[model samples]
Target: MFRLLIDADSFPLGKGPMVMLILFLISTIFIFARSEEQGQKLEFWIFANTHFEEYQTRVPIFEAENPGVNVQLINFGGTMHDKLLAAMLSNFGAPDLVEVEITSIGRFLKGAIDEVGFVDLRPRLESEGWMEKLVVSRFTPWSYRGRIYGIPHDLHPVVLLYRDDLFKAAGVEMTEVETWDDFIAAGKKATRDLDGDGTVDQHAIVLDRRTESDYFSLLLQQGGGFFDEEGNVIIDSELAIETLEFFVSLFNEHKIATPVYGTWHGDPSNFAAMQDGKILSILAPDWYVGILKSQVPQMAGKWKAISMPAWKPGDRRTTTRGGTMIGITTQCKNPDRAWELLKFTYFDRGGLVNRYETTRIIPPLKSAWDAPIFKEPDLYLGGQPLGELFIELAPDLPPRYQNPYWSEGADLLNDAIFAAVTEKQTSREALTELAAKVRALIAKDQGRWRDL
Candidate 1:
């Protein structure tokens, strides 16, 4: 046992203490700086649409496949614009990749996108010659601004979804109603009350006119356009009038649709009402199939789907309805890797297969058409190969509206269309009013919306 030397106020040892303190501080800062620079999130930031939860389950699959790669999702509401804007401005809020709806791609491409944060996928496409893999027709929306900005997954056609049981109970079959005229007649039959009760518990059709994006499909199918080549509102033309009239006929003339179907005329919610069995049929994209299966599993095997009716005795089959695109946001730190995931999720065969297997949502890509998932006749969809129908229908689709103000004008137009369908406003009054308001909005935007 040696005697300990006590230093109460030791002047000599104090220098040692100072040196240790400085060294400790330096070490602490070095460690912290290094940890931050490494940027460990144990995840890759990705944005997605409503089906994210189902996709998230595959994270383990992604990690297993990519080794160290891990992905995490930041779900913004169904509203991509609002969420994306919040993220872009924060710069810190930006996700590595953004999943944008195809219908809104033009808008995002034109306005919502952060000018700095995008990786032009053209180089990748050309270098890899992935363009050969793509059916050029399927890449329509991604072609805006003369450059490829996003990778497309599937041609999500807006098809008709109907309750087979309801259609059968009404003594009608989808095959018999190939044209719009026949559809109305069948709808009238399906509109009846099963119990012979006074009140009609089920509506024949649910037309959510409030969904402006959806309505655009019919408009474009009918040769109606929201804007011209230079970008100006074109909803006031005779075609626009005819489109509105057709939209309203479900309520005004056919008597097949009830208040539930026509009430939201402009603001459609076929997914909600149709899935809930409040209505017999709805018009939606293949993306809706997954929703139908997931939300109303009980209705599986009972629901059926068909392509949109021919516009002019086969003037091309149908127009593009709605879909999502995977683009690298400007805020992304790992665009190359993020784009790889993007290509996999939408354009890659494996990604398409996974989406179909887990969610049954058809991709817009061409090759996936032959994938076993698409070929499988869905028991829920009455053994129908819904995937084939979408594939055959995709090439004929016109460009889905992709302009920034298109959605804005559409929302206003739908409000009016909905009102007219429900008899809140006459058809003429509604369309005219909508056109005027949209024009005003365009004028206010002072960009592509100026008068023709």
Candidate 2:
């Protein structure tokens, strides 16, 4: 045992005895560490390989504030979708907190899984006033029939990334290309045989044939979707047919766009196309900036972003694409503690600022827009303030919904897009077949939503 002794050399020197002070500090630190070690451990499963470093940096701050709680940030690499589905189906091994991407969350939002799978957060949202703090549109993707299951982590507003050097060389001005027709004309002019190879060596745009960004981004920008407000299948609508025709015409008719080999990441063809200067522009979201920086650093400072060219003069210029949301599962034992961690990680002012500053992720919280981090100029985009552009485009985005059959629908649509663009079938014919197949699926899966 340690004995407490009082030193009288200078009546404790007005600072207490040195040994006692040192022991007190040590005991306080020990108690704090022990409390944190014995805290309620909440498991958080995340699938973002790119943003993991930034997340690791913020986890400790949350743990420090909530001394009785510890969060385990587990990264499941690229197979999170399959793993999550398996867990939800088997009703076991589900994490307390799970980050679901926009492309895959539709499965969790519909069907039997959605009925008893996750916690409905609307009550907590109303009590905490989080609805006003966050962008309402960001939550739309994670919302099911009359329920919100998750909180969005960021707003992924789409933008047109163009090479200024290529644009200047092609004699195309962004301001002059306001509509899709103008963009098509510019594309035709931009495609050229720069090296005198007797073949058009450079095209105006490159698109991912697999992911069908043209269908999702452009269709949404034109206020069209695969489904309507009442969850009806409408992929064969006039707007969708026209959008499909226009997207295909860029490659088949104008010969201004190149079809890349794969979707989004690890596609050597896309990487080579960008490096060889084979395209003038690519329509992508703000998150693609990070991909460009990490995957093709050589092209830094040569690219700039602009609002998406409108379908018509007064049409919406931009629409959102990809994002991730954190949902609390019904498997969560300590929901109150999990909510505390979620609030600190996402809604906390300091965490939001740090995330934006470090990762360039546009937070969904409206209050975060006022931070000085949003005003910082990006060096990769020729000193363009990309945040301001996203902020401007985020609010006007048209509402979008994903049905339970979106995964199947996306697959069928990708096939339809491939068929139409490859000249195997007409756009209308392919989409009509697609709509038929999707309607059959919706009917077979559940008899009620087959009215399309």
Off by more than 4 A, model 1: 1-44, 47-83, 102-116, 135-143, 193-202, 259-278, 447-452
Using TM-score as the measure, the top candidate is 2
Alpha-carbon RMSD to native, per candidate: 5.8, 10.7
Candidate 2 backbone clash number: 0
- Inter-residue clash pairs, candidate 2: none
lDDT of 2 by residue, 1-452 (tens): 77446544545555456757778999999987965543288888889975566668878988887776778888997898789888878987788888888888887766553454678888999998989887787777777667888888888788888888888888988657788888888888888998897988888888766666667788888888888767899999999999899889988999998887456534766877787888788887767777777788888798888889898897888987788888888878788888887787788788877876666678888887888767778888888988888888877776667677788889889999999989899999999999999998777767764432
Off by over 4 Å in 2: 1-39, 261-266, 447-452
Clashes of 1: 21
Best-performing candidate as measured by lDDT: 2
Question: In candidate 1, what are the lDDT values of residues 170-195, reduced to their tens digit?
Answer: 79987766678888878887787656
